[model samples]
Target: MNSKPVTRIKKINMYKISIIGYGNLGFHLVNHLSETGHKITQVFTRDKTKTRISKNKIDFIDDLELLRTDADVYFLPVKDDALKEVAKQLSLKGKIVAHCSASVEMKVLKNCTENFGVFYPLQSFSREVEVDFKNIPILIEGVNKETSSVLNDIAASLSNEVIEVNQEQRLAVHVAAVFANNFSNYLFSVAEEILKKENISYKILLPLIEETVRKVKEHAPSKSQTGPAKREDDKTIQKHLKFLSNKKELKNLYTIITDQIKSKK
Candidate 1:
C-alpha cells in the first residue's frame, strides 16, 4: 500500500434533523434541508397533517415525550415567547439543539441541552412565498468550539454567507432588520392607503419603489435618499401633512418619520 493519507471528502454530510415547530421559518428549513438529502427523522408540531411536512414519512409526534433523541440536530423555530417553555419540554441531551430567534439568545436553551446553538437566518420567511436560502445570510452562535463548528458547517451548507455573532451583536442586527424590513413595509402600507383615498392605482408606485430600491443597492441608502424629507422642505412636508389631516394617527406617524429623516440630514 502507498504511504498516502486517504482524505475522505463528504459530498453531503447528511445528518438526522428534528423540527420542533412547523411555522414559516421551520417549514423553510425542513423543506430545504430535506431536499439536500439530509434525513428528517422526526417532527413535533401542533398539526401533523400540514401540507409539505406530511409528504415526509417521518415520526410526526405532537407530544415531546414521543420525540426520538437519536437525531443529530433538533431545530426549534417556534415563537420567541414559547421557546423557553418548549425547551423545558424537550429531552435534547447529547444532541445539537438550535433555535431560529433573532432576539432570543442561545442561553434560552440551556435547560434543554448543554450542546445548544442559535441558527438565525437574517431574512423574513413566509410559507406562501418561495425564498432561495442559498443567497440569504445565516447567523449562528454556539456555546463552545465543537458546537460552533458543527453549526457553522450546517449554516454554510445552506447559505453562501454565514456569520458568527455574539448575543449582543445578534440583538443589534435584529433591531436593524425590524427597521429595514418591517418598518419599511408598514410605510408602504400607509402609502397604499393614502393612494387609495385619491383613487390612484398602487401599481403606479411599484416602478418608483423598484427604482428607489435599485438606487439603494447601487449606493448607500443615505446617499440614495430623495423626496422632500431628505431635502428638509418644510413647504412640501406641511402640504403632505395637511393632505393626511383626516387620518390623525397616520398623520402623526408621517410627522414623526419626516422629523427622523430630517435629523439624519
Candidate 2:
C-alpha cells in the first residue's frame, strides 16, 4: 500500500459569549454554552468569587466598565425593568447584544450596539434544577439578517427548535407562556394549600395533574376540558363554592374561572 499524507481538519473559533446576569437563566446559559464547546470570555455579575465552570477559567467582572469589547455576543438576562439601564451602561459599540426577555422589545438594545437582537428562550429556569436545552424553543429576533444569522447559529447549536420571530410574535408567545406555565404553577400551589388544610399530601394530586397534561397533549385543551363547570353541573359548582365560602379569595377565583369555562361551553 502507498503511504498517504494525513490531512487534519482545522477548527473554527466559536462566538465569544459574555453573560451579564447571574440569575437562573444566566446560570443555565453559561453551563449549556460552555458544555457545547463555546468560549465564554467573561461573565458580568456582582459576585466574582463565584464560578460555575470547572474546566476553563472564565473572567468574572462586577463592574460594567470592566466589560471587555472582545466578546462577539453579550447576553443580557437581567430583569426586564432594568434592561434599558443595563444596556445603557454597556459600551459595546459594534458587538452583538441580545436580551433573554420574552416581553421586552428587541429595540431596547439598539443603543448598546449597532448589531443587536433578542435571544429569548421559552422555558422556566431554576438554578438548582437541570434543564435539557435540546428541545427548548429559542426565539431569535435580530435587527438585520447578519444579526439574525449569528443568533440563529448560536441558538441552533443549543436547541433543535430555533425560531426567528418578530417582536410582536415574541410578545404574544410570552403572554401565552405566562398563562400556560406561570398561572398554572400558581394554581398548583393553590391546590397544595387546599390539600394541606385537610392534612393531605399534595402528592395525591400528582397522578391527576399528570393525566390532565396528558389529555391536553393528546387533544385540544378546549376539547379536553372537564369538570362541573364544563359539564353544566350547577349543583356541584354551588356545593364547591359553598365549601370555599370561608376562603373568599379562593371562592372568587373559583367563581370567575367557572364562569369563564361556562361561557366557553
Candidate 3:
C-alpha cells in the first residue's frame, strides 16, 4: 500500500459541511466541528425536532434531494447499517464523503462517491455529556492520496493524535475498543447495582475505580490486577460467590470473567 504521509492544510477556509445524521455522535460532532471554526452548512435529520437548537445556524433539510450540493465534505455519523443506503441515495458526486463508524470499511462508499474515507473519532459520545475534541483521537482512512491528506488535516486541527488506518486494521482496533470501553463500562454498571442492593452508595467505589484505572496507566493490566481471582484464592472466590448468591447472573459473570483473567495469567 501507499506509505506517504498525508499533507496538512495550513488554513481552513469557509467550506460547506453537511452532517447526515443527528444522533449522539453526529450531534456532538457538529458541535465540536463548529467550535473549531468549521462551518456546518446543513444538517439532515430524520426527525425535525432534533434540529430545534441548531435551527438558526443550520438549515434542516428533510428531503435528501433538497440537500445543498455545495458542501465540500459530507460527514455521515449515522449507524453502520444505514450508511451505504444513505450514500447511494444521496449520490454526492465531486464531494468528499466520510463516516465515523469504526467497523465500516472504506469500500462502503464506492457506490456513492470516489472521494470517500473514514473519519472515525476514538471516543465514547453521548448527547447528555459534552466531549472534548482536543483529547480525543481521530483515525482517518482515505481512498486516494488527496482525500487522505484532506481528512488528515481536518482531524489534526481538532485532535492531538491523527493517524491513517486501513479498513482491516480499523476493524480490529474497533473490536478491541469494544472490550476495552463498552465491556468495562458494563462491569461498572454491574458494580453499581451490587452496591445499591447492599444499601451502599456507589460513590464508595469511586476511589477504587480511579486507582484501578490509574494503575493500568503505569503497568500492564495483568500485572496491575489484584483481588482474589488474580491471587488464585479459592476460599475468597467462594466467599464472594456465596455473598452474591441472590444475584445468580452477576455471580456467573464474575466467575466467568475471573476465570478468563486467571487463564490469561
On lDDT, the leading prediction is 2
Clash statistics: count for each candidate: 0, 0, 0
Cα lDDT computed for each candidate against the true fold: 0.87, 0.89, 0.86
lDDT tens digits by residue: candidate 3, 128-237? 88788888889999999978988887788788898899988888889989999899899889988988988988888889999999999999987888988888999999
Task: Record all residue pairs in model 3 with backbone atoms less than 3 Å apart, i.e. clashing.
Answer: none
**Which regions of candidate 2 are displaced past 4 Å?**
1-13, 52-56
Question: Residue 124 of candidate 2: its Cα lDDT?
Answer: 87
Per-residue lDDT of candidate 2, residues 1-265 (tens digit): 7989989954434688999997889889988999888899888887655565434567788899888888899999999998989988987888889999988888888888889999999998987789999989999999988899889989988998999999899989988998998999999999999989999999999999999999998999989999999999999999999999899999999999999999997
Off by over 4 Å in 1: 1-12, 51-53
Predictions: Cα RMSD each:
4.1, 4.0, 6.2
Per-model TM against the reference: 0.90, 0.90, 0.87
Write candidate 1's Cα lDDT for 1-265 as tens digits: 8889989955646788989998888888887888877788887888756744444566677888888888998899999999999988877777899999999979889988889999999998888888898899999999988788888877877888999999999999999999998998998988888889899977888999899899988999989888899998889999999988999999999898888898987
After TM-score superposition, what is the CA distance of residue 72 in candidate 2 from its true location, in Å?
1.4
